[model samples]
Target chain A: LAKTTQPISMDSYEGQEVNITCSHNNIATNDYITWYQQFPSQGPRFIIQGYKTKVTNEVASLFIPADRKSSTLSLPRVSLSDTAVYYCLVGGSGNTPLVFGKGTRLSVIA
Target chain B: DAGVTQSPTHLIKTRGQHVTLRCSPISGHKSVSWYQQVLGQGPQFIFQYYEKEERGRGNFPDRFSARQFPNYSSELNVNALLLGDSALYLCASSLVGGDSNQPQHFGDGTRLSIL
Candidate 1:
């Protein structure tokens, strides 16, 4: 399992873009980076995933550099409803379990 | 289409008591996993079952156990429950082929409160 580090919290105003970055220095050759969002009283929902470079979806975008040691999750035009805990995970390979860090608390304030 | 489903949305138990939480994976999915989430913290993986066999388990104690049925539905059973065991028990499922890269879809979870 690749250990990941991320901020504890971040605050953003509604309609502003927010980006949360995660660092995984020991990322492996077949490792994939993924992000999940969790609201109060709900399960974590898949947001975006990527191996390298960049991957975008209707919800968010994931950007990875050549080093593969760090990745960022970008949410555009944030809203109050987007206030949630965002988790960046380094996918487990070869029967390894997916480990989660403390995660970034993204508060999309009005 | 129906999403992942967990039974007994909420439950309460006492010490030394045993409890079982049920989950129905999304149709056609084959892998199921269980996780425990305490307040103000990210979820902790408990166990993952593929093809009715245990694939992976976290650092959790032996009191935490789970099994996947032939239909891919799963049950998480906690024995001799402790107050600290009180938390949201989540169920997630993924396709076998997408085991590594595919995201696991989660159910709302069952809130277990131990007295």
Candidate 2:
């Protein structure tokens, strides 16, 4: 499994667009990048996923470069309800356990 | 659909005691994985079961055991629970296909408190 690095925390205001980046220096050829949003006292909710380039969904956008060593999760026009920890995971097939680093805590202020 | 469901939502057990936590996988999901999340930390893999067989396990001790039922639902059993086992036990289920990159869906975990 490839280890990941991300910011410990970030601050954003409501209606602002927030982008959090994650790095996996030893990314594998089959690894797919995924982002999950977690709120206090609840299980994580999937946001977006991508193999490379950009994939946009109703919830978020995942941007991956051709090298696939790093990816970014963009949350547009954030609301205070979006304040939560964001996890960036790199995995293949997606059944194996996802090892999480200290996730990036996004505090969306009103 | 119910998604993934676990119970009892909260539990308290004493050291030296045994406890069982149950999880119902999503309809048609064949793989169930368990994770332990300590306070202020990320989830740690404990075990994975697919098709009623043990497929993978993490670094936890033998005191931690799990089994998948015929129905594909599963249970995580901890014998002689230790204080270190006090944490949120999360159960995630995924379909058996390809590598594990399919983004496993999780259930609101069982919060186990060891006294």
Candidate 3:
């Protein structure tokens, strides 16, 4: 399992762009970077995933540098509802279960 | 289409008691995994089953066990529960293949509180 390190918490205001970075220095070659968002009393929701470079979707974008040691999740134009805990997971290949670290809690202000 | 479903939304058990949590995966999904989420921490993987076979096990103890049915449903049994066993037990289901690429759909989870 590849361990991930992220901020403990972050604060943002409405209409602002929020960028959360995760560091996985020992990430494996076959590992893919994935992000999940969990709201209060709910399961974690998939945000974005990428193997390398940049991957964009309707919700957010994942930017992975060439080294693949770190990745950033960019949420454009945040809102109050965007407040949640974001988790960065490194590996899920084959039969491997996802090991989640202490996620970064994003508190969106009105 | 219905997503993953877990039974006994909330449960309370004694320290020496045993408990069983059930999970029903989404239709057409063949992989089911269990996780334990303690307060103020991210969820930790406990077990993963594919096609009714035990595929992987996490760093949990022997007291924590799980099995998958032919229908792809699963049951997590914890024996001799303790206060530390109290947490949100989550179950996630996904299609078996490129596990990294396939996203797992999660249930609301069973909130277990041990006295």
Q: Find the candidate with the highest DockQ and give its number.
A: 2
**Stretch of 10 with least lDDT, candidate 3 chain B:** B96-105
Highest TM-score: which candidate?
2
Segments in model 2 whose C-alpha atoms lie over 4 Å from true places: B98-101
Best by the lDDT measure: 3
Shift of residue B107 alpha carbon in model 3, Å: 1.3
* Model 1 clashing residue pairs (backbone): none
- Deviation (Å) of B38 in candidate 3: 0.6
Give TM-scores of chain A for all candidates: 0.95, 0.96, 0.97
Error of 2 at A1 (Å): 0.5
> Which CAPRI category fits model 2?
medium
lDDT (10s digit) by residue, model 3, range B8-84 = 89999999899999999999999999999998989998999999999889999999999999999999999999999
Computed on alpha carbons, the lDDT of every model, listed in order, comes to: 0.88, 0.88, 0.92
The per-residue C-alpha lDDT of model 1 at residue B84 equals 98
Write the candidate numbers in order of decreasing DockQ: 2, 3, 1
What TM-score would every model get versus the actual structure? Answer: 0.96, 0.96, 0.96
lDDT of 1 by residue, A1-110 (tens): 79899999999999998989999999988889988899877888878889999999998889999999999999989999999999988975324456778799988778
Docking class of 1: medium
Which wins on lDDT, candidate 2 or candidate 3?
3
TM-score of candidate 3 on Cα atoms, chains taken together: 0.96
Query: What does the lDDT read for residue B112 in candidate 2?
Result: 94
Fnat, 2 decimals, each candidate: 0.51, 0.59, 0.54
